[model samples]
Target: MYRAHSTVATPSWFSIIAALVAVMLWSAAPLLAALAHTSSPLQLTALTLLAGALATLPLSRSVPMARLSKGWQASVWLGIPLLIFGAVSSYFVGMRLAPAAEAALITYTWPVVFVLLSQWSRLRTLRLSGVIGALIAFSGAALLLLPQALNDGLGGAANGYALALLAACCWALYSWLGQTAPVALTPLLPRLLLVACAIAAAASLLVEGSPKALSSEALLAGIALGLGPYGIAMVAWDKALRLGQASIVGSLAYGVPILAAALLVVAGMSVLDWRLPCAAILVVVGCCSAGRRDG
Candidate 1:
């Protein structure tokens, strides 16, 4: 049976901190998209993962070689590397093809996907509120995609939207598998990240050849993404999940699109679109409603 077990009692403060970390992690989307303008998506993914792997080397060292080897072994058996590669690659591709804000909003549907998958797998049960909330949130997602569909008819931004949805599904599966895997993720994360980096690098080489020299802005942004969102943020998220209820953590994910949008606007990467606010409101409300305790 797939069950989530927290090593420590969850505190409201800790949950709040975890939620904030999640927001920060996702807020990197627009910045990453902006960097994609100067670098290929595959190259950017490779560089970011490589940076994250290097940053986490110290932690990896603390884990015994035997355990690390087991982690690598588990990654292959469990297909973690492929899952991470697909999710990250698709996300970057989608961001490159569409507005960062739209991609973020679409990918943020992972929580809902996670909940639904858990229920379908019999790992968890959803309350009536959860069902209602899922419907509402999904409706909001449709609203966000509807404009693109109407404008381009599956020829333009629709591809990006499809990729974003694929990314979301992949992410949901990854999270679920991580929770249920026999191997502990703390020891496995570094190995999995390194593997993902290798995959990204190979894909980049195949698709883009040797990367061209990047602009100063692109270089700095890539480094920041590696150290911040792809690196420390991941560590923080894992810690939080280990210490908190997965449900609460998942619920808090509704804040991601909002944070991502705000960050994009502040960075001057996106303009305020009326649809965004409306979609944000609907999604937030639906997700929050789904989280309500019925008992």
Candidate 2:
């Protein structure tokens, strides 16, 4: 993804709120998947992507035709389509084996990754606040995720960690490329999601044959995931990137793990503990630092 003119608009309340909306949707993902209990990861992936495609298709027309054409031209050569498929599919499969907190911590690194990639690609430079904030956020992530991983024994989650890393990398690349296209990739989000859906569906067909009949709850859960986290979250993220400073929006995402953990606890799938608040403070401080107007 060659750098385009800097795409991150000035920081704004709309961007911050949009990014926060994406975080909230993402926070619900683990809980939603647990409720769905869709038997096959691949099957679940395909279903959610299909739903995302359907949800985004109607929204595509909202963009002006001229903007859409520009975005499409910039996007076609960016490899964003592959990044989209990789990001969504890997995260779905990885969560099947990873702890909620650990998974959240790992996936949330995309912000830092995005900032670094953006800087390196000349899309944006890493500001001092971004560096300091990234370090602080990662410290918090380590605080939350390290003890848990050690206690659970990393061996059991080896595959999950690998997949999670892949997911993070893919997502960072996707977001960076989106900005590089200077948001020409946005109008194409539906198409990219649809491409991911097609690939996942084909893979599921070959590997698992056909999906098993799902419980009604599971079916509903799948739809909810598609329309919320996998679908609208992507849109919200694009809006955030378009409206906010990249580092700030990316850093704001540090809250995802905290919110996700809280959601799991409320759902009775996890326990509330001291580390949650401590990590929350660190993450919040980091987000504030990164988002400072002067930065």
Candidate 3:
């Protein structure tokens, strides 16, 4: 949920290249899902967790995840499910409620959530610039949500937005809890447990209460969920976030919507739209301002 900033202080040639690569993938995540037609968040979540769990086998067995502290073990068990469910449920649900652009934009509110929570918890003092950035970002997010809000007259797409907001809440909580967790920056066992729980949850939800059978497309999409955001993305992000500024990571995360829009166009699922790119610019600006305040 919290993508960390690039932490290579000296900025070697490799670090510079890695930073660029990270930004590109980070930006592209939401678009990747839209392009993939990642419809069922639950299925996507389950597969991600399963994949993460599978990834854990070699590392856990070799490194012996058991060697970690009890506190870390508990954190992993708690945080992993939070990651899977929070991501899967909210992302898919938001996609259903609104356009991918809108969902992605809405979800970026996690930064604001983090800032607020930090202030409340005495982790940091809230600043005027941060408040202003939040307001501007909220206004821009509101504009994107306007269509969904209007569409509520037909169905409760507005309610879908609410659900999406709820998903954001889960993400915020996940990030915050993870910060306090006692494991190393990258904890394979805890991450594995979280993914395993998510996989079980996703499997149960997808397989049960069925009228239609599982489509091959959906199955593949679930695998993408497991592999993409849930698998590699988490590891990369955790490693980075552990070493960098959460605000910067949160801001950079907004790039996902724009990336998703571009990918959607390439896939011919959607047309090129200008609003999301514009919103992304605003998100980046806000993130920069917030990062400055924190720095």
lDDT of 3 by residue, 1-295 (tens): 4433334433234433333445565455565556445344555555556765564443343335588788766666656565546655667667666666666666766666665665556656677767877777676676666665576652556656776677667777666665555544344544555655655564656664332344677666556555555555555555455454454444455565456556656767555666666666676566556545544
Model 2 agreement with the true structure over 131-241: per-residue lDDT tens digits: 776787667667766886778757657677678778878887876665655345556667777877888888889988977887888788888989998788877877787
What is the RMSD of candidate 3?
4.2
User: lDDT of each prediction vs. the true structure?
Assistant: 0.71, 0.70, 0.58
Please name the candidate that would achieve the greatest lDDT relative to the true structure: 1
Which ranges of candidate 3 are over 4 A from the true structure? 5-8, 35-40, 55-76, 123-125, 147-154, 189-213, 238-254
By TM-score, the candidates rank as 1, 2, 3
In model 3, the number of clashes is: 5
Model 1: per-residue lDDT, tens digit, 1-295? 0123445556567866965675677677566667656777788888777777776665563344364466556654347767777877788788877777877777776766766776667635667777887888778878877776787665667778788889888887887787666556666567778888888888899999987787877777777777777677776676666677766665566676777778787788888888887777777777677656577
lDDT of 3 at 30: 64
How many clashes does each candidate structure show, in the order listed?
0, 1, 5
TM-score of each: 0.84, 0.77, 0.76
Relative to the unseen true structure, what is the C-alpha lDDT of residue 39 in candidate 1, on a scale of 0 to 100? Answer: 75
Best by TM-score: 1
Instruction: Please identify model 1 stretches exceeding 4 Å from their true place.
Output: 1-15, 61-78, 123-130, 151-154, 242-251, 289-294
